[model samples]
Target: MNYFKQILRFAKPYRIYAILNIISNIFYALFGTLAMVSLFPMLNVLFGKTDKVKIKPEWNGLLKVREYSEAYLNYYVTQKADQGNDDVLIFMVALVISMFFLKNIFSYLAMYFITFLRNGVLKDIRNELYKKTVDLPLSFFSEKRKGDTIARISTDVLEIQHSFLSILELIVREPLMILFTICAMLLISVKLTVFVFIFIPISGFLISLIGKRLKKHSDKVQKEQGFFLSIVEETLGGLKVIKGFNAEKIFNRKFKESTSRFYNYSNTLLNRQNLASPTSEFLGITVIAILLWYGGQMVLVEKSLDPGLFIVYMGLAYNILTPAKAISKASYGVKRGNAAAERVLEILNTSSPLQDKPDAQEKRDFNTDITLENISFKYEDEYVLDDFSLRVPKGSAIALVGQSGSGKSTIANLVTRFYDVNKGSIKIDNTDIRDLTKESLRGLMGLVTQDSILFNDSIKNNLLIGDEHATEEEIIDALKVANAWEFVKDLPKGIETNIGDSGNKLSGGQKQRLSIARAVLKNPPIMILDEATSALDTESERLVQSALENMMKNRTSIVIAHRLSTIQNSDLIVVMQKGKIIEKGRHEELIAKNGAYQRLVTLQSFD
Candidate 1:
């Protein structure tokens, strides 16, 4: 419920709709009761049981207003009949019709007012969920499925809109309808009204019993939905791998298992939710049955109640059933919405462990060097970088090379502060990296990673991420330096062509060149190239390696590579084994030392 109230804060901008809705619903409830109450006088005059009034009724105290109003209406009917209008019965019928028409108009207005608020809250909540998802650190998603996150933002948000907003309407209009109906009943006969409510508590207890487990079942259903959606997400992302390995059947079976569980949970929850309507209606009929018997005694056996008024009381009594059923269904809706609200708030309330300190200063320069002093880091129980240290002075390039799992990549992760060190410090220009704002720190460095992370957007838009307002000449210059402009200019749309997902439409070398072009466009002071040309064909490698060399000119560069050829010309080369540095020197010095660096070059020569 606290989470639900937090969601409601998004509705603050749309509170005017709520106010107008409430005003319309007040009139809606008013006319809804009076529409039925208007039937009594018509029935009285039709049966010729009218008490002829000889004088006009005087103003009476507020407590006696009902009696005084009835007397005045009786006097009006008598006067109209004595004046030979002969349309007294027709007037009563017209009055009842007009009351119903106004009741429906107000009902329509009430719904019309709330429509925008409902959709507005939904849009704001989805926008907020997406904003928070992006703000969270990458490590937070390491333990969460992408599909489950998508389900939270899409499916769960829609569920909240339906259940909460619908129940919000129930909380207002339905109860007021019930309140107004009961008030009319009491004016007719307080005794009959008091007796009618005796069985309401029992009916309410039964309805509450039906919904006791709805929230638990709804939570189970939502979990199953997320699991199935995750399967779909993984399947689409790995379709090529699955087909290459002839593992389609295995993935199909897993998806089927997930969906089978989803089917079972959905049926159980919806069936339970579906039971609320009929059960409440049946129970309501039982209450009306009991009210008819009790109220019949006052009219038939006791003769204290007017036959006409007693029939109108029965109409009002049956009227309570509709709102009662609506309330019962809305109660179930609230239970389901609570489950979805819990999921959405779990993401929104999470605090990122990586945030810049309030006093953190922007780093605008890389004047001297980057220093890693006795740094230790871990991804799990094992240390990935233990007691490791390195430095790259301004205008120099340092290369890290080792066998896989030797923590070469972990150095890049730590240097960029993607993951903070568990111990010691990484400093830029004599300032601890943690003391610098993350945005400004990253702004000073450019990264080219193993995977080509391009969106399914036009090439021009993709390049614009490097500089949102880059002129056409700067974009062409960056592409030419990265060796990407040759093929781009030959394409059907040149740089305006749309690249497929993750640059699938382009060759491996082309994608790498585009990635490098983006970094070149940024033109940061420090460049980190992590195996930028390792996955390409020989021809592609030659083209991309040339681009990388052009991009690294006169900048501080940290290169992590498996290919010995790529790092041979680096100013300083460090050979690592099992998270410890074993060899560090110029390329020729390491080869002369006959250490791990020599063995690695010897092994790569055979490949």
Candidate 2:
């Protein structure tokens, strides 16, 4: 219930809908009890047990209104009997039908209003979850599974809707229905109703015992679902690898294992949750049977209760069972929903370690060099950048050549502040990158990675991400600069062609060219090319290298170089081994030293 109240704050926007639903529920409860109680007059008339009133019943106080109502009905029926009206029973039946009709109408109104509140809370929570997923630092995702996040946003939220938020239906309509029915039963015979109260608490306590372990099982079921979903997500993303390694059987076994756990957990949870309904109903019937024995004695043996009113009392007593059953089921739902609420609130309540300070402002442009001074950083226990430092002058192209895991790419990540250093600071034009707003700091640079991250959208839309208001001509010009215009114009739709998922419709080199065109469109003062052309064949690499040179013109560039020959003409070349810089100089100066750079060039046969 505490978890439920936390999520209820989202209903503030739709408070009017909730209020209207409560109002409708109050009427529905009133009408529902009246509908059952209306059966008494019909029963009395059918049994010919009604009394003939000699005088009209006087208006009595509220407490005795039930007696006055019965007295008035008796006088009307007796007058009709003396008038020789054969439609008296027909009129009574029609009145009963109208009471039932009004009851259903208000019941529908309650559900209709509650629909808005339930769905509105779902929309707001999912939107906030998605927003937080995007805003949290990338490091947050490193320790979590993507499918678990997807489950939190999709399945867990829906579970909360069904279990937690849907409790609104049970809280108002069902409880009030029980209250009204109980009150009506008291009016008919307070003695029988009092006997009912003593046993109901014991029944309620037993029903609650089923829900005690349900929450723990439900959490296990939800987590198992997330595990299987993660397996599916991983399998889809790695189909090519699975086929390449001929490990399809291995991954299939992994998926099967996760699904098997899911099956067991879900069955255990659902079967226990299913027990709540029958247990409550079975207990309710036991109470009803006991009421029959006692009430029958009061009427038949004791001669203290009337037969027709006792029949009405039994009808109203049965009415309470439906609501009691509903309440029992709802209690189980709340238990399950509590687990989902905890999962959802976990994301919403997490404080991001990466956020701009209150005094931060947008850094509009770059004017001077980028300086990395003795920056030390570690991802886990080991330092990836051990007291690394470098000075990249404005408009100068610096190429980084190193073996894999030599911390070349880490420099790109740090300069863009995708990560912050543990010990030292990076400055752009003498201002610490941390002091600048992340958005504006990143806006001053362009990044083109080796993987060529492109979306499934039209080529024009993809290019427009670099410049939203770019005209068609601007897109064509940027493509030409990327050496991609020739291939794009040959396609059927030219700039309007839809690139399939991750631009799969385009070839590797074409995708790379389009990626470069996106950065070219941005035309930032600084460019970071993280092995942008490394994955291409010789022909594709040559064309992409040409495009890279064109984009690097008049820009300060940091090139994480993969091909040794490509960076021979760079203004400065730095060779790295481990996390330390082993050599730094012009390409020719390093080649003359017969040092690490020269050895790597010989290996590539670029000397």
Candidate 3:
């Protein structure tokens, strides 16, 4: 119920539609009661128990509205009988038939109005969930599964729609009908209505006690749902690896375990939730049976009740049970939905770790050096960089050469602010990056990593992501500079040819080159190339290095290279080991000095 109140805020924007639905529900409930009450006249006429009526019937104000209604109905029947229609029983049957028709007509209208509110809320909720997902920081995904997130957005949210909307009739319309019917019953006989009131709360309490564990079980079921979805996503995404490793049996066992857990948890949740409907219904029938035994005695033996009026009261009492059972089922649904709502709200309420600073402004251009001032970083508990410092003067080239784990990539990540440093500052020009807007800081630089990052799009569209306004000529020229235009031109669709996922349609070197073309198209003042030519055949490496050299010209470049040959002609080379720089100089200078850089060069030369 608390979660429902929370969800209602989303309905605020569509209050007009909700109000319209409420109005229709009033009419729907009113007509529904009239339909049931209309059946009383049919029973009275059929059983030959209708009372003789007199004209000029009395009205005792609103307190006797029911008496006034009955008197008006008697007048209409007499008038019809006098007009030579003379079929009193037929007129009563027509009245009963009309009420049923009106009930169904207004019921449709009520549902139609509610549909607008229901779907409107659905669209708004999904849109908000998706927007929050995109705005969330990358760090938040570290401990989350993509499939589980997908499930939350798609399946779990849809479940909420079903649980909430399907029971909306019970919440608003049916309850109103029950209330009006109960009032009518009290008007007929307060004593029987008192019994009805006592029966309701006792049944509700007993039913709710049985459903006490519903939310706990539902939460467990939802969690297992996420776990099983994760396993399915993992299995499909890694099918190639699984087959290559011949671990099909192992994966099958793991999947079976996940589903087995899911099966048990779901059974528990369903079992508990299912009990609410039948248990409430049974209690309702028990009360009705007792009421029948008591009311029948009053009607037949005591002769204190009219047959027509007693029939209507019985109909109203039966109507109350329908709503009571529905509400009981809805209560269990709300509990289950609460667990789902919490899962969804968990995402909606998460604050992004990376956010625009209050004073953020877009920088139009880069005019000075990019500086790393004693930057140190640790991802979680493991320190990857310690007191590392470097400066790339504007329009100058500096390359990093080091063993693995020497923080070369860390430096690149820091310069781009993919992560903020734990200690010290990285500055673009003279302004500390922390003081600059994140978008403005990253906008000035372009990056090309060892693995090419490409989407499943045409080659032209992929390049155009760097500069959406780039012309075809600009794209072709960038591709030419990247040494990718030759292969692209030979394709049937040329730049329009699709690259498939992560550029899987292309060779590794070709994909890397397309990535270079994208960076070239961006034409940022600073470029970071992290081992750009490391994963290539000799011929491919030669072509890509040529493209790299061309792209590096006149730009502030930071290159992290594993192959000594790639950085031999670099403007400056720094050798690093164990999170610290051990040597720094020109390639020749470092070789002549016979230090760490010299050792690296000699070791790679033999290979």
Over the stretch 1-607, how does candidate 3's per-residue lDDT look in tens digits?
A: 7777777777788778777777777887787788888887667656755444656687789988877877776676656656654387787778888887887777787788777877887888899999999777666887898878887887778777777666666678878988888878878888888977887888888998988888889888788788778888888768889999999999999889988988999998888878888898899889889889878987999988776788788888888877788788888888888888889889988877567778866776788887788878987897888888887788878989889988888898888777788998988768888778777777788899998899989999999988999999999999999999999999999999998977888999999999999999999888999999999988999999999998989898999998878877888898888778888888889989988888887898798
Expressed as tens digits, the lDDT of each residue in 1-607 for candidate 1 is 6767988998899999999999999999999999999998898898988889989999879778778878988998898788654588778889999999999999999999899899999999999999999988778899898888999999999999988888767778989999999988998899998887888999899999989999999998888888888989888888899999999999999989988888898999999999999999999888888878887898999998899988999999889999999999888988999999999999999987778898999888789999999998999899988899888899999999999999988888888888889998999998998999988999999999988889899888888898899988999999999999999999999999999988899999999999999999988999999888788888998899999999999999999997888888999999899899999999999999998889999998999
Assess every candidate by TM-score: 0.97, 0.96, 0.93
What is the alpha-carbon RMSD of candidate 2 to the true structure?
A: 1.9
TM-score of 3: 0.93
Candidate 2, position 36, lDDT: 84
Root-mean-square deviation of every model = 1.6, 1.9, 2.3
> Candidate 1, which segments miss by more than 4 Å at Cα?
83-86
lDDT of 2 by residue, 1-607 (tens): 8889999999999999999999999999999998888888888888888898979899889899789999999998887777664667887888899889998999899899989999999999999999999888877889888889999999999999999877888889888999899888878788889999999999999999888999899999888788778888988878889999999999999888988888898998999998988899999999999999999999999999999888888888889999999889988999999999999999999888668888887888888899999999888899988988899999999999899999999999899888888988899999888888888998999999999999989999999999998889999999999999999999999999999988988889999999999999988999999999889899999999999999999999999999987788899998988888999999889989998988898888842
Model 2 alpha-carbon drift over 4 Å, by segment: 76-84
After best superposition, candidate 3 residue 545: deviation in angstroms?
A: 2.2
- Per-candidate local distance difference test: 0.90, 0.90, 0.83
